[model samples]
Target: MEWDWNFVRQIMPALVEGVKITILASVLGSILAAIVGLAIALARRSPHRLVSRSVGWFAEFIRGTPLLVQLYFIFYVLPDIGILLPPLVAGVIGLGLHYGTYTAEVYRAGIDNVPRGQWEAAKACNLSARQTWTHVIIPQAIPPMIPALANYFISMFKETPLLSAITVLELMNQAKIVANTYYRYLEPITLVGAFFLAISLIAVVLLRWLEQRYGRMEP
Candidate 1:
């Protein structure tokens, strides 16, 4: 079938609305993942062997599994145990947790890259552990990690389409609905691809800027 401008116009509002949800999920999920990843990274570095090993093993399990399976468990399986979440909440949790394992590795590497002298200096100054991490380690660590974190955010944005499986009305799901309603696959599907491509390219440009701004400052 031929491309139809009128049909495109009709579907644009719905698709735009879907894009908002897609971006919201990605942003919130990224924030949650960063927090979770930082916690996991810190836990794995605990002085206690049991705490460290347990967190390490749990992170590995999350990393080893497929995100789709995780999403299904959160959305479908949880209610069986008397826990229930909205579709969007379940999707956000799934994305955050699945990616948090990977981000934990990024955090580990960033933290490790800090010069050992910095830790020694903090100790020499009699800085408490809290003061040392807050004033020295994380500030130095996070700048270099921004590009990697941004990369994951872009990846999470793309993965938002997977939320469709759980009935979250993200871009791909909205496109699918439009296509089904009109029995026209070309326009809505093509539009979805176009939107994703545009956003991803923009994100890439921003990531490059971040790398240039922060990467060279690394010691």
Candidate 2:
């Protein structure tokens, strides 16, 4: 079968636009995950066993569930309960919440790696609990967490295709639409694969650079 360069060239603009949505969703979702995950991680580390246990159980529940089911529940079920959201809103929330659970675990690992003496030293300096966490522990922990966070962003990018199931017009969804309309999968699908590979390669290079930068700052 001849690969139709003309079709690919013509649809490049559409493909690029769709890729923009893919990037936006992933970036925004990662930001949400970072913020929410930090909170959840801290909650799970609280001195109060009830707070810790509840947060831990919620994180575990989210991690255990299928992302598709979560998406369906948020996008479909919530509307029936009168908490309607736009498709994009639902998609972002679902993706953010799902990955936030994983990011919370990453935060836990990084925070746990901080030396025990660091906490003692902060308290010796008369730092309050909030001050210790904000000024000491998180500052030390966040650098190591950046690489893992970047990797999660890449994972979220790949998962953006799932948003299409909820009717979000992300890259894969747009490609599928084009294919259905034109009765041609070759150009649209190939272009979509190439687009994803290119972006993923860029993300890998960026992550490596960040890891190097953070590694130098850590010690």
| Number of the top-ranking candidate, with TM-score as the measure | 1
Pull out the clashing pairs in model 2.
none
Model 1 sits at a Cα RMSD from the real structure of: 0.8
Per-residue accuracy of model 2 over 30-120 as CA lDDT, tens digit each: 8899888999999998999999999889989999999989999998999888999887888889989989999998899899989999999
204, model 1: CA deviation in Å?
A: 0.6
TM-score for each candidate, following the candidate numbering: 0.98, 0.95
Q: Which residue runs of candidate 2 sit more than 4 Å off their true CA positions?
A: 216-219
Per-residue lDDT of model 1, residues 1-219, tens digit only: 899999999999999999999999999999999999999999999999999999999999998988999999999999999999999999999999988998999999999999999999999999999999999999999899988988988998999999999999999999999999989999999999999999999999999999999877874
